[model samples]
Target chain A: MAEHPSSPIPGEKPRWLDQPRNVTKVVWALVAVCALLFLSDVLYEKHPTFAVEYLFGFYAIYGFIGSVGLVLAAKWMRTILMREEDYYDRDR
Target chain B: MTAIAELAMPISPGLIVILGGLLVPFLTAGIARVYVLLLSAATLVYVLGLPSGEHAAFTFMDLDLQLLRVDKLSTIFGTIFLIALFLGNLYAWHERDRMQRTAAQIYAGSAIAAAYVGDLVSLFVFWELTAIASVFLIWAAGTDRSFRAGMRYLIIQVGSGVILLAGVLFHVHETGSITFGHIGLGSIGGTLILLAFGIKCAFPLLHNWLQDSYPEATVTGTVILSAFTTKLAVYALARSYAGTEMLIWIGATMTAFPIFYAVIENDLRRVLAYSLNNQLGFMVVGVGIGTELALNGTAAHAFSHILYKALLFMSIGAVLFRTGTCKGSELGGLYKTMPWTTGFCIVGAASISAFPLFSGFISKSMILSAAGEEGHFITWAILLFASAGVFHHSGIKVPFFAFFAHDSGRRPKEAPWNMLLAMAVTAGLCIGIGIWPEPLYAMLPFPVDYVPYTAVHVITQLQLLLFAALAFTFLMRTGLYPPELRSTNLDIDWIYRRALPAIIRGLGSGIGVVWDSLIGGGRMLVSATIDGAARNFGPYGLIGRTVRVGNGVAWVATLLLVTLLIAYSAG
Candidate 1:
């Protein structure tokens, strides 16, 4: 609930969201998080009786594939299911 | 001390809320605000003071009905319901619509009553009351589409109530008891009850009403709606159907399907609606697991989910309030002006996504751990995937689109102070519960010793969430992430909304055409009858040609004499 610093330049269009340097910062931070998770595996207990989860980076891979699969599937679904917003109310 | 003890005697908070709601319309807006807050706070206090057993019992037609069933389960739910009511009232403080306020009180009151009632019959009464009361909030929006949507929501809700009533009647007939306790699907009545709860829980295909109706509600209306309805269903399920094996698969499906739908949803509020379903799946799985830990998980998850989901709804609702739209495609760069809202929205996102040190991390893990320990391999796998999917859409995509995406250049002001206050309190609780869950855990139906913040849990959850984030980054970089489109996705509701109606209408019109020709045939019959009568009565008839009375009389006598002779010969 901390108040975010107000943008310095008033009326200056979108903040530095798309700047290459900022994107890299986010990517690097993500990489750091992944690396920490990989490292934490050594200290963390392995409770998996399932074969798939015993593998290194199993959650990472599972999450990655699951997310990508969801997006792809949803996109494919949209092709079949998506229609104009008023599809329900259209007069035949 | 005796007066205090008397005051602590069991009272139905649900009844209080409803009765108090009746007073809302009469009070000035300011007084009404204080009235709602006081009513909710008092109810919470009274509910907390109740002993953990049935009180407030009475007889109905020689059958006993328990109006208040005070226990750990009801306590947790009632507490959260009251908290939601308080926050919801605060969020809705600026609302000028009197009906929304009144309906909120009744809806919340009924939901609280449903949670506390001790018998199936009493539960049914409050169950239907919830549906009947809540629909007014949707209709209070006063748009034609909202009115139509409200009707649909009402039909489904009250229809659930009807099913519940039938189930209860049959259950009492078979078992000769109306206790609202576990009756698994061994009998038809129990199954009917499960279906009734399922309809409210939004079990997969039965789920379309949630995504359909919640989004159509007014800004504050959606916030209030999200808190009570599905969670009430979850409470019902946990109450009666705990450890039912079927719930695991159903919950898994509930968890998985919505994330995909949420991914491509254009309306941000609707996306939250889907996430709400996904979160309920976790609770359902917990209920299905039926272990003490799992049940605790379900209760805790529900408590946290209500808070975070309402927070999410409130944020989007605030957006809808200010900008008049919550479409992902139409919103961006709101952080430039609405930074406080953006901040609170992120907290809600993080909590829902189950990041460590957030409310979700503590509660959602209980179900997953239960499934794994119980060796429901497939259920665990699906839940795990859904967990990551939750983070992908709700955690990242929601705030990303609404506040941080390529700026659509619309800068709306920050949410009103009351809304911010509500979000702030909810946000604090989200973090607070995540950090220290003992208070929440103590309220669970059973003792909870499971630790949520172990090295293994944190690492695994982080790994899953970060990788999902990585996947999002990769997809976006590759230009493969689906652009938010202003389109409606065909779902189960299509049957009732269009397909079924169209089929009935087509059949009706076909019958109508046949009916029109049948009427035409009747017309022809009437025309022939008219012509014959005219000919017989007019100049062309035999009687009409006879002008002289004597001649007619002589002919009639001759005909009568001839007929008489014929009759005598035949005899």
Candidate 2:
């Protein structure tokens, strides 16, 4: 949001979030969380209500794969669904 | 206190809002907020005082109508509706449009009426009223597109009401009862009623209306609209036709399909709209399960869903107001300027994605766990898959693209304090419910015995979310995520929006061509007939021959004489 007319903060103060380096920093933090969650999976008391719940890091793997699959599937769908923004009102 | 005690006895809580709404516009803007707040407060107080049984009934023609029902079920829904109305009105206090506030009141009133009704006729009446009143929200956008969307939204909403009315007629005729209660889809009437609820519940194919219309609404309008409509349908389904097994599949399908649509959708508001549908799927599954625990789960889920979804809509609405756009393609790195909005949005995102110590985790797990308990193994699996899918689009994609993605070079100002206050209140509820769900659990229609904070459950939930984040990171780093493009993605509304209109236009043109040829053909035929008549009877033709008058008279006389002569001879 660097270009809004309201946002030309005179002498724009530097913030931690604005630094591009923070992207890498956040990525590493996310990875560490994932790793810790994955490792801690074994120690948790297992209440496998469904057979699938018994699998190690099932939710983690499921989430990652499901998400990747969703994006890919949507990209494929865009071939059919994507149209000009004025698709419905082209005649207007 | 005595006056309120007397007032409570005379009417249903719903009418206070509907009637008060009529009087709201008379008040000056300065005290209008106080007036409206007190009105809602009175409604809540009245609802609290109403006995937990059918209270208000009257006869219309020969039909007995129960306008108010206050059981545990209605009580829970009523409480939430009042809560939502109060918060929604507070959020909209700064809005200048008098008509919109009036409409919002009517909308909330009708929803409360729908929740509290004890008979099919009353239900049907209030059902249509909600549809009619709430379309104003869509129209409040005051854009041509919103006008059209509001119109379509109204038609479908009314169609559901009509279907329900027809079903009620048949059901009453067959059973000799007008009570709104359990009936499976075993007869024509039952199936029709089921279809009605299905449409409103937005089961799969009938679901596109939610996505198409809600994003087109005015900012606060969308927040209010999000709370009542679908959740009302869920309540109706729970009231009348719980445990209908087909809802299992309908609910499952609802959960699964929207994530893909959400992924490619460019409007961040529309993405939340899809996310709303996905969350409804969870409630639908619970109603389908129909166990006491499941029904309680549905109620609790709806309660939290309303707050969090409204929170999401508020955050997005604030962005739209500040920057005049919510397109994913047009937004990024907003947190640099609008930090409060960004934080509240992430809270909303986290709640919807079922992060631990957030709202969705507590309510959604009950449904999933209940499905496993009931041996609906396959339904369980699909829902499990959909949970991850929900986290992907709603949790990661919404916040990531709007606040944290590559800078789109926009730095809009922070949302107004009122907007942030609204978001903060809702966000607080989301976390409060997550941290201590007992207050929410105690209010459920059925005793909610399920615990959401089991060690295994929290771990699994976190795993699901964090891994989804990893996948998002991977997609972003690899450039595999679909770039936000300014494009419209067609959905089922294409039937009415494009396909049918195109056909009508084709027919219109075809009819025009045929009409032109028919006019030409008729002219030729007319000319031919006129030419022949000219030769036979016109002044320029045989009649114009010399001595025509005398000769024609003589010819007629001779023919008459010949006929007489022949008759005499024959005799």
Candidate 2, residue B369: the lDDT equals 82
Write model 2 residue lDDT over B167-213, tens digit each, in one string.
Answer: 98888878888888887788878888989988888988899889999
User: In candidate 2, how many Å is residue B61 off?
Assistant: 2.4
Q: In candidate 1 chain B, what residue range of length 10 has the lowest lDDT sum? A: B2-11
Clashes of each: 0, 5
Query: Which portions of model 2 show Cα errors greater than 4 Å?
Result: A1-11, B1-10, B535-571
Superposed on the true interface residues, model 2 gives a C-alpha RMSD in angstroms of 4.2
All models: lDDT? 0.89, 0.86
Report the error of model 2 at residue B557, Å: 17
- Report the lDDT tens digits of candidate 1 across residue range B264-373: 99999999999999999999999898999899999999999999999999998989999999999888778878999999999999999999999999999998989988
Worst 10 residues of 2 chain B by lDDT: B2-11
* Candidate number of the best lDDT: 1
Q: Model 1, residue A7: what's the lDDT?
A: 39
